[model samples]
Target: MLVSKKIPWVIKYRPRKIDELVNQDDAKALVKAWLRSWESGKPEKKAALFYGPPGSGKTSMVEAICREYGYQLVEMNASDYRRASDIERVAKVASLQKGLFASKRLILLDEVDGVSGVADEGAIEAILDLIETTKNPVVMTANDPWDVRLRPVRDKSLLVEFKRLTKTEVLNLLKKICLNEKLICDEEALKFIAEKSEGDLRSAINDLEAVAEGAGKITLDLVKQILRARDRVLEPFEVVRNILRSNYVWQAKQNASQTDLAPDELMQWINENLPLQITDPEDLWRAYEALSKADVYMGRIVKSGSWDLLAYATELMSAGVALSIVNDVKSKYRWVKYQFPSKIRLMTQTKEARALRDTIAELIGRQVHASKQKVINYVLPYVRIIFDNNPEMAAKIAVGLNLTDSMVRYLTQRNADAVLNYVRELRKAISEEVKASKPSKTSSGTSPPTKGKGKSTQTKEKEGRGLDAFFKKT
Candidate 1:
């Protein structure tokens, strides 16, 4: 039986011809003209650069156009070839080679902006060399052509901008997909996804797929769940701005409920930015008072495990806080860039530092006969001082502890690249050690069955049974 493999919706529904591309008529026309110029032996511009925000169909359009015109597409990402020598070895050869069966070639360098600094030495020069010498047309795609590194490529190529798909265009595409799949989907849900996508058709399609999983019908609630899980949360600044500006309770409540933030996180954001938003002293004081009450409700909810109290907590934080502003002072509130809560930022940093500290303590405790707490309090300070003074010793300790590059950097305050290189060497050594330790097959076709924990396989199985019987009695 031949079972067909299931393809992803993104690939399955992707446009295979240029005309099928949405809201990119100008780009399509420009590309078509550029490709047509190649028939006369050489175009005025040897290459065309397609640049736009991701999921705007830049790469897809170029590929489809090449396929439609029977041109052989040679695709390469900039990340794959970082050095001048790497580019010269692969791209230079590929560019000069003629396609079999009279098919014209098109070399595509995708995400050219990623090649950077020491890694990209001579890469730009090599690409420029190709532009001057290659008979075939070259195409490149990037999210940003205006990026400083891509200037040389931009100068050598004809720039064609791919604009984002309009909301109507995206919604129509979603509706068409739903019809093709024969999946029931709410119109409002589709529209919401389209609007929220902010012109990225690819993201909207992915979101639709996620929401439609394991379901015959797609509901607004299902769409909301997908959006929430994806963290398509309300921007804190926007939410804070609206809350302060809203005069009616329902409007404030609506704004608050729409956000993915819990009451506590939302309260922190408001607490951080409220003073800047409101100029009136009395309004500021009133808002803080409402926040205090919201905190109290949150504490009670925590103590009692009363999830139903969350609604009351949200109301106090949002509507209560909004209504606290005096009537005359309501119009005084103006939107500014909301500052992130410093307390939250500090707490996050502290948490990460504590985790790293605990990891180190645990590693040391395992080697020496002591608790993690004891190692942390009694030994870690001396270890830090030793690591600070001796780089070689630090590297040895890091490998012995099987510590990651990030952990090594945090503890020793060494250069990131040096720490990463050391960690990589340690990992390679460990991998080689494991490979060397594994038993090799004998001259016979079949290898002997392996023992577990120095016991024969059968004996290990018996011990497993005995442990199971012991556990059952307990």
Candidate 2:
């Protein structure tokens, strides 16, 4: 007798035919068009880059195509091919050859954007080189196609985009999975799970499996217990809506725990949308008063380093602000579209620029032996002035201070390229001077130093001889 193996619902229910995929008609149609283009021996674009949110079926859809069309699927994880040599050694073989068992092959490099840092710059080039020579189709996927690192591949390949599945789509998929598994799952429970997933179908399936494990039936209470304990990256809009709409104190408090946002960040979100939710002036005043108290708690936490105050802060922010809508309770239940905090938006917009400024300050601080703030306010302005006015002088300072190319660029935007080139020339000249002044190789391979120490001092400094001298003195 043979026992059957249990498979994950995600894999077990993966679409084997193109038609099985839902809510992706455009992507499917695009893929099918490309597949048909293969009939002429080659398509206009030899490669396709699929990009979208996770569990949007980027990889699974490719698998379906290969299974349905009788083409062999050769899957490669992007992490593995990090170097040019790694790609050449592995992907090259997969790309140029027909599958041993099938007439055609599809080479998939999954999560191309996840290749990581400057280390994989060569791997990207190698992939481009592979595409030029391969007789087969090369497909890559990423959560973000706009990443600067993927710019080359973006230009070189056909781009196919996928969107996060809708709540309705996820619900239908869950219903189908429950039916197939013959699991007695409550409809409300399934809907709650789908809502929690935020359109991540893969996570929703896994969530369902988790809740159903070792149980004859799944219930709303069971889902709530498990999912609440499992934190997710919740959108501020969802979190604030849930918290503000919650009727009871515990419910509002529980809803606050749904997001992974920092307490202060979440505070900004709540503060921004509070006015939109509470219309009456008196009710709005009450909400703001509670929010201000929460802000007080935050300041205390920062000043006194009392983390225990965080619970009170969270309570005030979530439950306190929420329950303050007592003057006109009907406004609390009204549907209001929320906006992200303008404060947070400005911070986000300036974050990279601030980081660059801080990095430049830190570099300068190392040479000047000053605090980063002091250097930023006092020293950087002068450096910027020198960079703009005196190219040669600026290059010397850049080299002397060991500032990187980006740091120099940060100092002066207009003269960045020229200053960088001058800095490079200075470096080359210094390197050659050091080389020429290294003193021609000695006439003798090994010679006694004509330098500092006397013979007795030298003997004492020598390793094994020190012990002998100690014995002689004794």
Taking all chains together, each candidate's TM-score versus the true structure is: 0.50, 0.50
lDDT of 2 by residue, 177-252 (tens): 8897788989999999999888888999999988888876889999998877676656889999888876445567
Candidate 2 stretches with Cα past 4 Å from truth are: 1-5, 116-118, 232-474
Q: What is the lDDT of every predicted structure here?
A: 0.75, 0.79
Q: What's every prediction's RMSD, in angstroms?
A: 26.8, 28.1
In model 2, the worst 10-residue window by lDDT is 460-469
Residue 298's lDDT in candidate 2: 100
lDDT (10s digit) by residue, model 1, range 1-474 = 123215667777889999989888899889888887888766989988898877899888877977798888887885455577877777778789888765678888887754532233477888888888887888888776776666887899999999988899999999999998899989999999999888887888898888887887887888998788875557877888787765445557878866777678888988898888877787778888988999999999988999899888888888778767753343435546789888788879799888988988886786576899999889998887767776655665676565666677667775445555655665566545434544573232243443332234454443333333333333
